[model samples]
Target chain A: MSRVSSKMALAVKCSDTFNADACMHCGVCTAVCPMGIEMLPRKLFRYVQIGLEDKVKENISTIYSCLLCGMCAENCPAEVNIADNVRFLRKYINENEFNLS
Target chain B: MPLPTKDILGILADNLNQRKSVLPISSAAATRWAKGLDLPKGGKTVLYTGHLYQLIPIIDAMSGQMAKFEDSALTKYFGLGRNVNKFINMTFFMGMMASKDEQKDYDRMLRNIALLLKKADVDFGYLYGEELYSGALVYDEGVDGSFAKHAQRVADMFKKNGVEKIITVDPHTTHTLRTVFPEFVKGFDIEVKSYLEVLAESGIEPTNQITDDLSLHDSCVYARHENVVEQPRALLAKTGAKVNEPRLCGKNTHCCGGPLESLFPSESHRIAGNRVEQLKEAGGSIATMCPICLVSLRKAAKGSVKVNDLSDTLAKAYGV
Candidate 1:
């Protein structure tokens, strides 16, 4: 039942802060995460990059659980803003799913 | 079985929107720390707590309740609790569970910051009861719309008070005021500095010497976002205390697992326990500059190692 929405992908790509595409999948972020959530910014960025809404939805609890401590973004050789990207997903979820705004 | 993130976030947003703080603390309780300090009301330069330190005990108490709820079947009722909280403010009862001694401990830390500023001969005023919570938790939780509105309100309050500069107490408040606020509030030109930064620049020599080793836990906001890494270290150095850096320090500092404390208590504690292990390996008494870090590490350490606010260590060295 899940289909990629170009709109969602476009919105995420256009965000200056959510540089998920720049993620190199090096696992540096996962190594540093205190929560030890295995996928974290690395896999989460991949989900965002491929426009896998279902994947992101499946990991919604994981998304909300991020510490957003910037430890990943700081250590990322790709210089992706991992924490801000997580914030973007949270903001996205808050708006689309929860209808907070 | 999933954490009730939506319910928790919704409740926090509602509180921020209505009460001007994520937690509903009375003005009297919030301002009790500044009593007998004789700090003036407002001026061009002011000390803005953002209630980060003041709200800690309540946050701790509520998190304890939340941990219990998470382990039991009561977790499902969080949605109903959120709805009920809209009218009754159930967190008020949670706030009652905050230990008086813990509240006083946090208050004393604020007092020490003030006393240290005075010792440095830096002139600052307090907003006292007029201060707002800076919407840090909502902002951190990605409740941007609520945060934006609250940030505007805070900026307007500053404008009304003629506050040109703000000296912040904790890292989260410092980062929000220094970096995040400017983005949300256009022309938000207030000069923001942490008391650590102010004291570092002041070259305030400590009145006493503490020849003890300490592990400094840097708040992620202060270390990475705010570029406040050296200020606290330099201030601590003046106290004659040698600070041992854990594996992750400075811009690469690890989180205290705080940002998730409200939404995911168990995960937060798990992270905190991990950080405590790293800090303990570094050897020495632990010193955390941020209130969240202090509480998190202290909870995880569980008296295995002494964890304290940096202010307590600095206050001891300053003989305040």
Candidate 2:
């Protein structure tokens, strides 16, 4: 059984004001990433927006891997601030998971 | 080396904050800054180190802590065991590693900037033991709470000290103070200027001359984020060397890869290499505006190109 959390989605959304709902899933952010690391911004948003906590958890590497360089946001046709979203996810993951001394 | 994890980075931030800095790095740089100084004369201009230059000794030490992350427990758990070089990012453990490396060059660059500003009579001063890290690394690493607290403490210290204005040395500090602080702290008001902005405003003509072709590698923060692109070129124009432009220059500049260098070393190296290739194509000794850019780009260029901070370049121009 997989658990879903509206709280996580709400928190992530609040952390980054850019409405992921307006995302056309156009794959432009992935194309624009300098690292050429696809499967992020759009993919991560899709999982989070749907409240799939497990799926979001699974993509932790992809979420934190973003440099938050704003390159994708700069190039986004929809004007989505994907970099801030990545930063939010990173903050969410660090607080929700992981043990740090 | 094993990849740096949140646990490690968090712990390191906690530790560094406990002491207010990587003490060795700060203390060593302080020793250098104090050299050849007379009795204290108070100045209204607070020369904020932003803990970047002071942390150089620690950064050099930490950047050297590479291990076999390909087989580490974290890598195996994350399924990041393959593609060793390209996949790993540094944790704060790497950043906290203890070493005895000489911070002379780092210290020298900082001193030169201070001396140049003093020569230009900006009435600059440092906070000595009171200065704190701008929590930039923690903020960038997504450790928001730690950074917020640090920012508050730094802001409070500034208020207590009656710091009228600040001249920041690096872009990370400059950007954090100018942009990030306001968001985290209410009424986080203080006049902040990067040293380049200070120099440009001073309009001092350099007495020393450079015969070499001088090219500029703009730090992404200094160039794109802060719009401090033309000021350094203007200074170089007045000083001596004719400025050369890389393919990725000005607002469209490429990053030096330092931010990701911690999070993605191999990829950072690859980007930096590409940037260096672009810079070398423009063909000249590289002059940089940020300390991190000087380190990252120099790591890529590997001494084939002479790289220096704009502070050092101007210091030479003033025959310091």
**Per-residue accuracy of model 2 over B1-320 as CA lDDT, tens digit each:** 33555544554455445654422233444545647754143357788887686566566565554323323555433323222212233323433463434356777787888887777777877777667777777776667777777789989988888887988989888988998899999999899998888888887778877765877888877775678988888878866687889887786677777776555567677877888888888888898878788888888888898887778778877766
C-alpha lDDT of all candidate models, in order? 0.88, 0.71
lDDT of 1 by residue, B85-163 (tens): 8998776897789999999999999999999999989988999888989898898788999999999999999999999
Please list the residue runs of candidate 1 whose C-alpha ends up more than 4 Å from where it truly belongs after superposition: none
Chain A: TM-score in each candidate?
0.90, 0.83
lDDT per residue for candidate 2 within A5-91, as digits (tens), equals 888767756654435777898888787676677677898788888778888888776776676666676668887767667777777
Lowest summed lDDT over 10 consecutive residues: which window, candidate 1 chain B? B65-74
User: Is model 1 an incorrect, acceptable, medium or high docking prediction?
Assistant: high
lDDT at position A68, candidate 2: 63
The sequence of per-residue lDDT tens digits that candidate 1 reaches over residues A1-101 is 76786767987878776776666678988987777789797887787877888888889888988888888778888888887888889888898888885
Query: What's model 1's lDDT at B239?
Result: 78
- Give fnat of each prediction, in order: 0.87, 0.30
Model 1 residue A15 CA deviation (Å) reads 2.8
